[model samples]
Target: MEYSWIRLLVLVACLFPALVECRVRHYKFNVVLKNTTKLCSSKPIVTVNGKFPGPTLYAREDDTVLVKVVNHVKYNVSVHW
Candidate 1:
């Protein structure tokens, strides 16, 4: 009887993660290098979609956000949330 109870608890614990509901969101970003005179210098700066500050990412609770970044610049770029 004790063994059956232990087995039931283990089964519920294993299946708990599968019972949760979640959604996934996807986004794409293109990285490029452009020349601009923003800080008193016309230097080439790396930006995403031609923007310096990048874009705003929105998501809800229990929702997963997946972003695909493409780089076209000569330098390395790293993006994080």
Candidate 2:
């Protein structure tokens, strides 16, 4: 019985690294405003990476997402998921 416990402890120690890992993903986003023409009108519009609707974020179960948003435009910025 004592030998069995020792074997179990060794098995768990070997598998610990495989079971625990850093599962976080990091992303950086820059927000800027530029004059764009739409519907025959020109105006400054808010954009994320130069896109109006921004980019899509993808994640999996038990995964963490870290986003850093930098504002370089003269507008109040807000991000929502």
Candidate 3:
């Protein structure tokens, strides 16, 4: 039983990095200003690519993603994901 567990551990350690790695996805996020009046009053708001809820990002298992955000407005911007 112990020998089988050791073998399994070794197999997992060797094959895990090779099966899910080396995939890097680059995404560009443009923070711009837009006016929204969907619910009530119209006001200027910040958005990514002119979307209210930002943009949809997709990734797979063990994938590396990099997001580059460019600020077009006169405000300090920060992103959390």
Q: Pick the candidate with the highest TM-score.
A: 3
Per-residue lDDT tens digits of candidate 2, residues 1-81?
A: 999999999999897856666578888889988689989999988888888789887776678999999999776788887
lDDT of 3 by residue, 1-81 (tens): 999999998899897867655678899999999988867889999999989788999888777889998999898988877
lDDT by residue (1-43, candidate 1, tens digit) is 9999999998998979756678898988999998999768798
Total clashes for model 1: 0
Q: Give the better candidate number (1 or 2) by lDDT.
A: 1
Which residue window of length 10 is worst by lDDT in model 1?
14-23
Lowest lDDT 10-mer window, candidate 3?
15-24
Give residue 50's error in model 3 in angstroms. 1.0
Model 1 CA deviation exceeding 4 Å by range: 1-22
Q: The CA-based lDDT of model 1 is what? A: 0.86
lDDT of each: 0.86, 0.85, 0.88
- Estimate candidate 2's RMSD in Å: 6.9
How do the predictions measure up, each by TM-score? 0.64, 0.66, 0.69
Q: Assess candidate 3 and give its TM-score to the true structure.
A: 0.69
